[model samples]
Target: MTETSTVLRTGRKFDQVLKGAREVFMADGFEGASVDDIAKAANVSKATLYSYFPDKRLLFREVVQTECGRMSEQILSMVDETQPAREVLTVAAQQLAAFLISRFAQQIFRICVAERDRFPELGRAFYEAGPRNGCKQLMDYLEKAIAKGELQIDDVELAAEQFSELCKAKLWMEVAFGVRTSVEQAEIDVVAHSAVDMFMARYGV
Candidate 1:
């Protein structure tokens, strides 16, 4: 059987189907979303949909993974290994924090939490696609910085997680709960710089 990821790159029709499915999933969420709705939205027969994605759960997982993968690519692309530690990290933190608090990100997170018990792999895939990828990208930057004698971190992985969490701090929870609908660039800048400051305080040489 062809996997969603494999078919994802095969042709235009596959792209259309997944894009349509993504819209339906985002609008209705996991449990509320129906295969019929997805097929209609995709303008494909149910058999066609199922051929690409074995089930609704698999479709949802692929949709979430696709979004996460795109975001991770953009976020990781923004990190420049050759830049100074503070400069590189400050930019990285700002972009990461912005993405984390965006409405779309929050919705994806909520969906994953709602479906996690029924479908643990979705949650694991979400974690792997976003946070784990973030941690690895940050760790790579930190490792490069350490090699250049720019940082003094003993545990790169923990530092990567801490720095990522630090960037989110108070705002992620607020955005996720609808306590606020959006964040200002100024506030993002403040949080990013603050996170970088704290991170460097511990690890900067």
Candidate 2:
């Protein structure tokens, strides 16, 4: 089920609930987080939490969607769509690399994978809200670049996906696999710029 279809209601405290849910989910994960803890963290009564989100799954999904929206907006604000593919893509790749190595993103990804067998829909929802959404944003920007004769992409969707993977390269895998505790800015720049260079080599006109 989609994130929007799962929302039961909204009110003044909607954002407050979401903030609390996000914190708890990130800390305790989907299965470990409890309604009581979420309610306490939100400083809302159980009844109030239930009124806003009837199910824990709905709350978790909402948090995921909200976080994804924030990430997309952050990247968009950092990127200049009017710029050439090289410039715009360097910024985009840097942001993507930063996010891929982020603790929050890693935890959300792990949660989805860890619970996928029991709650397959959560995995789908996360994919649609997170990775797929990011690709769509990149696709839009790539289309604009194509129209401007800056890039010559045969398949915008595939190119977007490839660029994202290129950003991950060796850094994200190292972080995700627990081989690295943190990534330096230099490392991010190296990976991000290399990704941009590789992408432009393939797609730039």
Candidate 3:
């Protein structure tokens, strides 16, 4: 199904159903989550759930899109594009690192990869809402910084993408691979600061 045709309907309880689905999906994954369990968690009936989301895949797609949109909004609100590149990039890195280590990110990524063959739109939704959105935001900041002579970069898009990858340096792989189930604030800070330092080293004017 196409992205626009994914959801069947929306109502007052739409957010309620999504909340319950997100909780269940996070706990049990895509294949493991049950309609009964989701209905129970949402405090709604199966009929009510179906009215909002006719298919389980559609519900999952909605959850991914909603959560990723929320994260993107939060990131945009936290970072000021007018600030010095170091300060702006540090906040951005910290946010990116924290997002990378989140259970939501990990779970959604696994679900998309596992279900890609059957539901390619799921991966597209995740990428457009998550990484692609992030790069676009960062690219705007990089463009301003370049204009101010605070950074030297021929390719703002590449710099933005690199900055995101650099933010993932120490934490992303371990969290993604299940080697670490939890992460500490100190560790996140270390990765964020190191990413900023490295990014500046390569681009600072």
Q: In TM-score terms, which candidate is top?
A: 2
TM-score of 1: 0.91
Clashes of each: 0, 0, 0
lDDT string, candidate 2, 1-205, tens digits: 3335557556888888898898999899999999999998998899999888888889988888888889899999988776777999999889889998999899999999999999887888889998999999999999989888898989999999999999999998899889999889999999999999999989888
lDDT (10s digit) by residue, model 1, range 1-205: 4234443346557777788888887889888888899889999988888677776767766776788788877866877777899999998899889989976677778888998888777778778878898799889888989999999999999999999999889899888878988779999999999999999899999
- The stretch of ten residues in a row with the least summed lDDT in candidate 2 is 1-10
What lDDT does candidate 3 reach at residue 62? 83
TM-score of 3: 0.92
Candidate 2, number of clashes: 0
List model 3 lDDT by residue over 45-163, tens digit each. 99999877878878887898788888888888988877888998898888889998898998899988988898787788789878998899888888889889999999889989999
Q: Model 1: residues >4 Å from true position, as ranges?
A: 1-9
RMSD of each: 2.3, 1.9, 1.8
Q: Which rank order by TM-score, best down to worst?
A: 2, 3, 1
In model 3, pairs of residues that clash are none
Q: State which candidate has the highest lDDT.
A: 2
Off by over 4 Å in 2: 1-9
TM-scores for all candidates: the values are 0.91, 0.94, 0.92
lDDT of each: 0.83, 0.89, 0.87
Which is superior by TM-score, 1 or 2?
2
